[model samples]
Target chain A: MSTPDPRLSINQGTLKYADLATALRATAEAGVQAIGLWREPVQEVGLATAARMLTDSGLRFSTHCRSGFFTMPEGPARRASIEDNRVAIEEAATLAAAGAAGSTAVLVIVAGGLPQGSRDLIGARERVRDAIGELAPDAAAAGVTLSIEPLHPMYASDRCVVSTLGQALDIAADFDPAVVGVTVDTFHIWWDPDVLASIERAGREGRIATYQVCDWKTPLPADVLLGRHYPGDGVIDFGPMTRAVMASGYDRDIEVELFNEDIWATAPLEAVRRTAAGFEVAVSPYLTE
Target chain B: MSTPDPRLSINQGTLKYADLATALRATAEAGVQAIGLWREPVQEVGLATAARMLTDSGLRFSTHCRSGFFTMPEGPARRASIEDNRVAIEEAATLAAAGAAGSTAVLVIVAGGLPQGSRDLIGARERVRDAIGELAPDAAAAGVTLSIEPLHPMYASDRCVVSTLGQALDIAADFDPAVVGVTVDTFHIWWDPDVLASIERAGREGRIATYQVCDWKTPLPADVLLGRHYPGDGVIDFGPMTRAVMASGYDRDIEVELFNEDIWATAPLEAVRRTAAGFEVAVSPYLTE
Candidate 1:
């Protein structure tokens, strides 16, 4: 794989609730090298129309935004989760046909705090694995790879319970390599003691399905449901992490994914522009020549 | 060692600006069984007066509040940290003489954040070990155990670098058992994946010097410096954690330590009473008959 171009890739969710065509046109004009299309946008425009627009614009397709919230242990919820991921795989496939440059890898997985009254972390993990396992064959058949994104441990309760890269890799290991992988978002795993090692391992295993960048702000409030910092503002040491990804021989587009209140409050184009600049400066020192 | 009664405790620095005599009088009347004193409080009333009050009131000293910001790596600054810890050890000895029950230990250390321009976590960890090694002998001689409190990783940048119970135990293992041990604070370490294992290990190794409790709230603002949640109001899975501590053969008082704007706004007695009530209710499910 070639070293990921550091230009810019807009995660569609950043402009959530905005008109898809307008957002796409603005993102492309802002000099973004690629765009991470989401399900809602594709659904709204009709997959065919969305695919044709991407083809006409000639923008590189980075990985799809997501597909996985496999936390419910059993019954209707687990079946519903599998069906949703299958739809996400189809969305990725549709985007791929529309002229996305990369493979149709649907980012799979969501995790959060355990169900109330549940104290069994290992058991909850098993539930995640089982849910993903059930969806793997379908994803592979649809020509899509499931990219499990491990959220920050703080979100282990209500969001994505998969809190570490290692844990994600463990779940991936249970499936055929072609069917499962991971999305490395800096915001989630930046504080991990084993982040560098895990990044390298992800590269070595060829499981680095995505590389997302963001910063970690200190004095983060006890309630962090939507309070992330922009890339340059927080204290996460991203230098070694970038180097580890590079050394692992995984060269891919670095996606700037910020979930900050300040950015969300601004115009979508403004957030995109600021994010692109932050990514360049923050990762400049560690970028491979 | 006998389990110290949890009732006889005085919150150090409760009267941050008040004279030590006044604080001690309030502590005595509150019917607190012991006092968790701070160095500055003693200085304000003069060691002679503060010592007399504790002796007069028959208050036992549970433990001193602190002594470690061991993250400054090198030269005079690092040496100063060691000397300051020594002073704290001396002060702990004085409190012990003033009717403090059992041996008095300085809350050994707080880990400092990433040094300027360096993201070398391994190197920072080494500095912590060195600081502890330098302070151990003086603390042991003063009859003060250096209780290494593993702070929350949120404080991993500017405050405490030792962010997990396991990390504290590892640092303690490098020293004489008599001089070093681990203090487990829920506020600081409740989020750790390895907390239960570490606590069990601490108990097996007889290295549990303290156990404190607090809650973690959500919708946390980006600035964590001002974000602390009162006990029973946040996402910490304390019930399971408390049960794990008890299972580890730790039969000790679970100190209720909270630092939050809401609590600080209330009268200290009210804060104490509410905290006690929260503790009883939250941990009741996990208590062994």
Candidate 2:
């Protein structure tokens, strides 16, 4: 009997230690068809060279890691975030320009957390929406889809005020689907009871830009950011979530994004292999089911 | 200018060190109108003695700590949870019978998290609903309202499957309001964007059983359970939540329940004073607004 394909892609953060070259090479060797790039590594590898590397390897750049810390207080901080996002949009365009024909390279945006010492989440969210809306035209022209990834509510106060898929869609709804959409990352959203319905709505609305997979684990790391686990290792049943997004007509690549300190400590290649296995166990069954 | 009233009712858990007698005496001396009792402390002091203490001090047993761990595997575990709930209902009955005229004693149910090694939140939630439904007859007969507390999603795995007021109300909708209702704890529900609306709906449906206040502090303790802070020490804006519950026509005593290590380490009497002050600063303004 043949083994099932995990249909996996690696988000660079899953192997935080790997350089762009090593990560790109590992993606091909790991037998995955795509890789999600973080701006820091992409820039370190030099954007032009990184884009060419992805093109040369015939690997899809599933998404440009991020660009949407638009929640900072107004003035230089806010202006800087918008300007940086513009550059990210341009980078996303270059990466998507070389992907598999119709694949839309997505720029996953983690709307910045609350400004230091500011507890005004409502105001922060409004600022994020305005910032994203302001960038939509540039995103449309560049052919890069801006995907709003709502962080978990635990991060609502200091990381991202957008804590729900419904909230992400609310902001995305105000822009063109070609320019703005929502990313569904299981680790961040699985706890949401309404997530399934939200994914369905995003699908029907043609706003499902990307689907990132990871499991939610407990005794969250002190950093909290390093707490994400590979699929099947935690309480989250990725089957329901994966199947829901799939049923929503999301046929695009699914990236197994882990931020665990343990996972990152391993060799990037070995981590990719384990991620593939985890994905097969946790998510592949649902694909067939 | 006079100091604002805390309108506080300390949950015995807030002072986990305090015995029932100490808790009762401190609550009365703290100038608060009520106290929420945990079963262990009540049983330790003997139910009859605890009831007499509450009566003697003119303190209302705003609620009985809990009864709902129905998610355990079937057989002894499940039966034990139901049986325990029955005893708690009886205890709640005894406590409520001694309350000041017009006060309805509540049984705050922290629906247990997922059963050992299980990951089915939906199933666990259903089991909770069924378990609560089974106890409704006893609750009705005893005149103790069963409050289904929707804990924060962070606790959905091991503490409570009901993670939102909407979910709690959904389960409660299947039962009698006089028997089953929902708890709105600021620490648990503050992260929910739609909590205000859910509170209003709970009020309209007459399912608002109790209101518990505490602030949500981050860098959660190793044991996330101890992460709660006194109001105003954290990011939760209690004014909107307090006013929403108030506007819902809920006139029952509000209980300030903290399960923080720092709070527990304080002298019970001193903790009461601090909790009172925190409530006045974080919640009193909303009462007037």
Candidate 3:
């Protein structure tokens, strides 16, 4: 097999079936220099033990998988979500500090969908902004950056109300760039008319927390969430986007975060190897030139 | 039974199985004042006969159910598509004149998906603009307003390259507003953050050709294309969107176009009744309020 790309960080979502130990081991053994962690696996092992495992594995952590579903009205559920997010901020900071030197203390946020029995999308989006505002101080205190992720518009009703990078940046503008930023994921925003311009703005604003790469193909699976593809496996031309991100002065590890069921069923190490190979073929070239 | 909203037009797609006669009879029997015609059924009866039947039914014609799949590169296929669009424009003018007073000669344009085996979304989009430019004169001569529609981004790759109202308006900017306008469909654009502002801009620019309404619910069907719902059944708060369109001085008949398999399976007249009822509850109040 060809050597893995050094800048490739296998986001744990790609190896969905893998637990904490398996994910880190698979990523490192596949010759990938970095790995992004999910909260479930880390919580399963408990944060302290997860941190120890990361230190021993010697792989860098690119970002914490995610933690931001605060689209609820102001109630106990909302309060609980806010408190849980505070704990997540601490977790992201601890994990980053425990990982290798290049690890980044960034947390991806999938802003929640509209509240149940509600057609108030505008209200839900406002709650996302309020949730971020409530969390920004905590993020700054914990030295973690909350990266708002705009999922594809198909998920706007039930998964995320924040469905555009420009919207994400607009929300991020209220907070300090270091404490709040946006996640640039290709699978979600590749179809956007304003995508390149948004990337340039993100870079100019100094708020691209992490850059994730994946492909989007149609005849999307029954579970739309699992329709993501390995890089170059679908129709997305990564050239302009990758170059735009590069042009934005984002010199961080690039992540491959697949959500396909077939990929999840493959062996973790094999999946990591395949991810790195796809990244090398589809995205790495744009990184350099 | 609740009196049907006078402005409610049942788009033929909602009664997918209905032939032209059946659709018109069902819609008219249900007391709906207007209807939108699809190309297939109209072609089945031949446009002239369909026009006579529409005149006989005494229902106003709201729009021509779409003909614009010109996202391919310059070739025989592109030429064929442009010619077909010209024919469609003539059909729209003929049908509009044949229908009752207040009928509109609007041909809805669903700009086609990326050409097969092509990842060039930008190129495909430009081709759509170019095709529109080629067909605008034919539309103008026929007294047909080509209404450019922005499909939901989920269909961005395989169905329509035009995926935003702003993008549609941008493309229409080059042509006279009377010749090229936009279809404001709630299902496709309700999730958009800039939707209200875009609608206002469309009105201000004199480009609001048609306003179609449908609801979006999640766990989209295996065929995502058929995931739409009647306006009141899903999570969309139509108040703001409906109010925005009303504020734009859009006095044209509003259409309820749906593509759900279940809705299609219903008898034509019942489906029309349900659409009007849904509109009555979910959208009509906002119109006059």
Candidate 4:
């Protein structure tokens, strides 16, 4: 097989079934230089041990997979979510420090869906802004950048209220870009008519914390969440988006975060290799040489 | 049941299996005041017979439901789609003339998806603008308003490229408002952060040809196309959207164009009644008194 792209980072969720040691081993064994970790596996081994294992793997940590479903109103649920996010902030900082020198202390945040049985979308959105406000200081204190991710609109009512990069940036605006920014994932925003402009704005505003690549296709699977494909495997034309992100002065490892069932069913090492291959073809062409 | 909202129009798609005669009869029997029709059922009876039936039903015609899937490059298919749209425009005019006073000759347009195997969304969208340019004169001559309907972004790949009201209005900007307008549908755009602004803009530009309502719920059915629900059955708060459209000075009949499997399985008249009931609770309160 050809050499993997140096800038390709394997997002852990792509290896959905892999445990921490296997995930790290497979990604590193595949000759991939970086991996983004999810909370479950990190907590499975505990933070310090997970960080030490990550260091032994000799790979960079691109980001902490996620932890920001705090779109609930003030109450027990909201308090629990807030406390969890604080822990996530610390996790991100610890992992970033334990990984290779270039690791970034960024925690991707998915603003939760509408509270159960509530049709108050406007209210739900306001709460996301408020939740971020509550979490910003904690993130800053932990030395972690909380990256708000704008999920696909299909997930608006059930998974996330933040459904656009511009919206994410708007919430991120009140905080330091170093503490709170946005996650630009092609799978979620590729269909946006104003995506290129939004990317430029995110850059101008210095709010792009991470740039993740994936592909989107229709006749989406039974579970829409698992419909994301390897970068070159679907209809997404990565050229313009990749070029736009690069032109916006974003210089960082691009994570391939496929959530497809087929990919997860494959061996983690194979998945990483395939992800690297797809990224090289679909996204690498637009990067600055 | 309570008297149907006078402004509520049962979009024929809500009765997916109903022939033109049955759809007209069911809607009129439901005490609904108007309807928007699909070309298939209209053409099934032939336009003249359909127009006569509509006149007999005594319901206002809200929009022609719909015909504008010409997002391909120069080819025979594109030519056929354009010719078909011209026919659709003529039908909209004839039906509008035949319906009771206050009927609108608005032909709803759904810009087709990406050409098979092509990822040129920008190009596909441009072709929609170009196709509108080509069809504008025919529409104007026929006294028909071609209303561009931006389908939800989920349909961007295999259904419609126009995914936001703002984008639709931008395309309509080049033509006279009377000839080129937009269809504002709640189910398609309720999640948009800029939906309220787009609705206001559509009104400011005199481009809102039709206002359609339906609800969006989670765990979208296998065929995402059929996941639409009766307005109040899902989490979409139609209040703001309905209010914005009304405040935009849209005085036309409001169409409830649901595309759901279970609803379609119900009796057509019952489905219309349910739709009316849903709209009364979800949207009617937001209408100008």
Candidate 5:
């Protein structure tokens, strides 16, 4: 029998349209052994029911799909966001608990964009740092790592102030490596000139929690959120980047996280198949084993 | 009478609605002593006519809009882009010849994005470097500097591959600083985490050829090209950035470059007035007389 590709994992966002049960079944039936789950879909499936289904499917969890919009204005809004992240950390712990032994349990933190009517990106970034510091203890207690994912500069205004791996690492450096790390998403950081060096530094520091892959395409959709193409379908040269991640000692599952309307519109099974096929071409060659 | 702001210049792009003569007239009348000319409008008005008009209007030429889409496929396509840039250099020289003397006549080079059917950004960037090497002599002979402008990463796929000031500097370092330099456009690089250091490096290296300012706004227009807001109308903190450019030993015109449908739709004179107002509020404080 052919060896199973242990590193291949699909983020639920690639199958965003499917219900939790259907997507999990499609993933396992396709021989993909792990997934990165989004919070909303898990909530829709009910956390307990989602956890039970994940346990039954025998697939592992890599990282939880994010919760950190801490750039909210002072008072109730900011407090609520911090409180929400605490719950996300708990949910991540639960999700990881149902997975096989040694599987990663990470809560990805996407630093929110500027608060309404505020042009203070530096201020926003500081708040993200404060929020992460506030949550690191909960993350450590829950046995889940908090991975800060730096979105591309394009998303800096409305999505994430953390626009480079360097910035994410700077923020991550303040916390314990076991509790705070950084997620490297190719779609978000392919254009950064400093990324390769940052990746090397991330590896040496033992802080690379998760490595996500998705190609970058152009004439982006009106929403821009739907702009990611599947691996090998766009402009990113993934072989070198993925190899860099592997060299960084990141032996965990390489999650294929995509957010695109066209890919999501495909039948769930086909999406999984396509993702696997893309992984083989764009990502598999970098595997050491 | 109050002293005229020598550093403030109007890039013709901010007056997308005006004819070249009207724009020049409006700019000089508004007490702006310098202008950055776009090639299309210059061609439309006739290059010689445009040069004479500038001299007559007494407005010095800061920079020529752009002329470097060198990422085209090889043979005639690539050669044609090189030839076009040569022409652009000559035109820039003519614009400078008409100036009051000692004014910089710079040609902006926007590194073209991914070649059609090709996703090799590294390859595209190398081609840009090679194209600059080939053109440096012509630019030097014409006494016009070739200024590489690294567009924002959002434009990395369809517009330009030179996505960071550091990358542009790496390319510029290979050629003579007198002939090859880099343009610092705030709108294109405001999100860069390394910008402050990059600006200092450019100053130390003597490559700060032109400094352009425009504000960054979100929910970009359907056509992202038309999404730039006037400075201070959007979220950029320009004071520190402008100060960084000046401290870089860059004593050149600060061109206010904007690309937006709404701004373009405004009356030509009002657009210039608003640009001047924005410069005074967001940028003037940092300029040392």
Candidate 6:
């Protein structure tokens, strides 16, 4: 068995605007251990076709990009969102069944901002919890572990309402450990004061399912939706973060996911290769034997 | 006594590069109840001169812009930073003595980010705590309650390492309640999952000293070194935040502090007046009689 570096996984978002086949080929060629596939790319090539390519290229599957949006106001829209996430879970299971290494774990959630005409953040959070509770069963039956990805608090309004690791674990603790888990992204949770403690708790509880890496830039623009730096380029100190994750006993893939205009503007192959190199350099100190 | 609208106050940053006296005069003319002053302006015109003008215009002093840099890594720089903050506390005391209405508090805290080659965030936080511990005595003696302003998590690196209300309060809890308190700026703490709970706790403990407001925009530009947006123009759900602060028993002035380049580029007076108006409209619902 080849002992590859688990810290070098590719998140499809790094090459989001690029063609799926082209992106996958580039990722495989770059020697990344795994890739986090998104729904859009799978839809583009058809799931079976994409599965065949991954099979051919020997690319391992990291957690899928997402599967949660259960916070919409009660109505058809909410039901539709839940159904869509179910489909994502099913897709993850399909990939697992098709010989991708590791369990079929779906990066289960992103926060949806406050509903129209609503001024209650607590109510919004309750809605998120209720929505996830509703989806946990279907996810479990499909042999998929729902990994709640707590986004940066900056996205608390429009994106994931799950803004901290502690909050995510609280939600996960409500469900069976095998059904619900937490995915720790360095960019999102690095600023959290209780992150290290929370990670330790999650690890002890066996809730950590995946790990992601990205950088936080300084003088961040007032608009954060599109602002993200490549790992090691920004201010987030990942040394302690890596040590904390490793301490969590989570020997999972560390996916590199950046959302910067500058990196996105470059050629897809070059971006993937550059990201792999950056990842190696950024996390080299924390890499365990 | 003319009862000023407590909800409408101006933070000097909204004016960007405008002259402080000019901005203050315009804010008073615009009928704003109070203004949050910065050190540069107070230094430029001399605190005594600035105080005299506020006395002449009958403008309320809501809070001083800042007085903390307690997070500097060991050495003369850290000591020098704390000394500078002490001067700011003295400046706030000067403003209070100059006939400005209400409790005058100076924001005291630390500079965040990797100090030189230090990659340990937890260690940085400890340094910040120690710095605060060191400054509390001087602040209390000056009759200036150093308000610890918890900046947004995005600023966890280079700005203020204190990124949440809970974290700020935790540090404050270690000091004499009369000496250290917490400042709640909507721009900074709105994204926190536990914001409401933390605010409530602050109120229960009488730690809620200063409050400010602004909005968060998505797709934010990479360069935020300039300024952000006015209260109502961005994506943040200010209504919930306003209610949360009010519910926390914070009956103090709610200052409007926007770091927006667009607003700053305009005449300083114009920016203050416009922001004051925006504050009235955006936060009117939560204002108590």
Which ranges of candidate 3 are over 4 A from the true structure?
A: none
TM-score of each: 0.86, 0.96, 0.99, 0.99, 0.95, 0.90
lDDT of 4 by residue, B139-217 (tens): 9899999999999889999999999999999999999999999999998999999999999999999999999889999
Worst 10 residues of 3 chain A by lDDT: A114-123
Flag regions of model 6 displaced more than 4 Å: A1-7, A115-120, A219-230, A265-270, A284-289, B1-7, B101-103, B108-110, B217-222, B225-249, B265-273
Tell me how candidate 1 scores on lDDT: 0.70
How is the predicted docking of candidate 1 categorized under the CAPRI scheme?
A: acceptable
Which order, best to worst by TM-score?
3, 4, 2, 5, 6, 1
Q: Give residue A197's error in model 3 in angstroms.
A: 0.5
lDDT of each: 0.70, 0.83, 0.94, 0.92, 0.87, 0.76
| Candidate 3 per-residue C-alpha lDDT over A1-289 given as tens digits, one digit per residue, 9 for 90 to 100 | 8888888999999988899999999999989989899999999999999999999999999999889999999999999999999999999999999999899999999998988888889889999999999999999999999999999999998999999999999999999999999999999999999999999999999999999999999899999999999998999999999999999899788998999999999999889888888999999899888
Could you give me the TM-score of model 4 versus the true structure?
Answer: 0.99
lDDT of 5 by residue, A113-155 (tens): 9988888777898888989989998999999999999998988
Tens-digit lDDT string for candidate 2 (A1-289): 1232635678899989998888888877877778888999989878898888888877877899888888876799788889999999999989887665544679999998767766566778789888997899999888889999988877777778888898899989988887899999988888777888998899888999999888876767777778899888998887777888889878788887888889989988788888888888888888777
What is the TM-score of each candidate's chain B when compared with the real chain B?
Answer: 0.87, 0.96, 0.99, 0.98, 0.97, 0.93
* DockQ of candidate 1 (2 decimals): 0.31
Instruction: Give the per-residue lDDT of model 3 (tens digit) for B201-267.
Output: 9999999999999998988999999999999999988888888888889999999989998999999
lDDT of 1 by residue, B17-120 (tens): 44566656655555555667777777767767777887887777667777777676787988887788777888777877786454345454566777765556
Task: Report the candidate with higher DockQ, 2 versus 6.
Answer: 6
Ranking by DockQ: 3, 4, 5, 6, 2, 1
Alpha-carbon error at B34 in model 4, in Å? 0.9
- Between prediction 5 and prediction 6, which has the larger DockQ? 5
- lDDT per residue, candidate 2, B85-176, as tens digits? 99999999998888666456699998888777787877887788788878899989888899999888777777888888998999999988
* TM accuracy, model 6: 0.90
Each model's iRMS:
3.8, 1.8, 0.5, 0.7, 1.1, 3.3
